[model samples]
Target: MARAFCSSDDEVRRVQSALDEAQAGRARTLAAFAVTVGSDGAVAGLLGLNEREVRVARRTVGKDDAHRVAEALWERSRLDRQPAPQDGTPEPDSTAYPNEAPAQPGPTPHVAGQAGEPESSPAVDAVLTGAWHTGADLTTLAAELGLDPDFLAARAQQLAAEGRLTPTPAPDHTGRHRRMVEGPPPPADETTYLHWHQPAPQSPHHQHVSWEQQPPVTWGTPVTAPQHAWDGYLSHGQYSGTTS
Candidate 1:
């Protein structure tokens, strides 16, 4: 029994050694094919294995699965290297399998405000023109220009400072009265009065009246007729001594 177990172990080692040699040879072949065509990812996808598994299969020995992966990679490389159809049509055999032929990448689509392209120039011009002629604020102009309001406001301020654009004027608040805090009413004993003062003398020949020396004549104040002779001459229907 001991001799038989030893013989079985030796046979297993021999078979494993043979598999290691075959796997190493297949890995070398697959590596060459991978260099010629696509990367480990493409080859792994063709073999239905993940990238890590494919890499491990390439390195580790005694893996019959690696041989199968190697064969698939070799075939894929040959197909990729084949000449394109002369008539600009896809080769019939190339489309036999879904992923047999890699699709040619198309040009990327353009996005507004992309890094390389300058989209702000025309936008800034439109905003400035609208602001100057229409007197529209940054929020309204941003909506019209389809731009960010904050960005538009900042740009508008910069342009206005540079004298490239005129900023919209702030709304007038002159007549808009705000509510004032009410203070305590005036003292009850205090009397408020409206007074009418006498007009200055209009004639150059007459002496000028100095109003600063006279007290203001209130509503109930009395007036006496002038003693001068000119007072009768000056008394006309239009002239009234009483203050209205």
Candidate 2:
């Protein structure tokens, strides 16, 4: 074997490859990052350039140094978009910071009935109300809030059942977002109605009860019918005799 003076380029590449693999496993996807920063164009825009100059990678596999550097910028943008505590929405995780989200990315996702039931909380209700009124994307909002989209969606259904929201919000085919809601669920009115028809009076010879026209009945309500008298006899279109 001949000895030759050579740099550690081969060893360096091997170690660098391992490092890249480890970081890639921990890092968020480019699409996820783009959502935080607005869009693929936005991630590149942070470099004082537009989409035409540098198109943000849609996937993570082929990302270059620019995408890696853009992570810090994307994280900051996400934080800036967080709902302020004073706004009544649940605050983002305090431990989350730029480029440090890998350790703690907001609160652990809640799947409504899985981790815990989706109880109606004031903070959640406020967020749902604002989203409905302002036409916000529920899935994106949930992500920003560090919540499981399904959990937030289940919460919306619970709110609707409790008469808080008018129409229930549903995810589209892709589950990327929820259908728009116009307003809080309309107030459900409770009503009680009584409907009955007295049978036509008959002469002493025949005794039979015939129901007259009854009032229109609404669905999902109780209807009552009274008893019919047997001894009553009709005379001149009126009951003429009374029974003891």
lDDT of 1 by residue, 1-244 (tens): 9999999999999999999899777666655444444477887788676787656645553345545666777689899999877999765885588787788899988654436433558657665656554544444555676766545544545454566653334443332122112233233332332222344545644434443344332222122222121122223312222221
Top lDDT prediction, candidate number: 1
Collision pairs in model 2: 165-185, 166-184, 166-185
TM-score of 2: 0.22
TM-score of each: 0.23, 0.22
TM-score of 1: 0.23
lDDT of 2 by residue, 163-239 (tens): 66543333234211221132333334443222223435566445422223332222222121110111112112222
For all candidates in order, the CA lDDT equals 0.53, 0.50
lDDT of 1: 0.53
> What total of clashing residue pairs does each candidate reach?
0, 3
lDDT of 2: 0.50
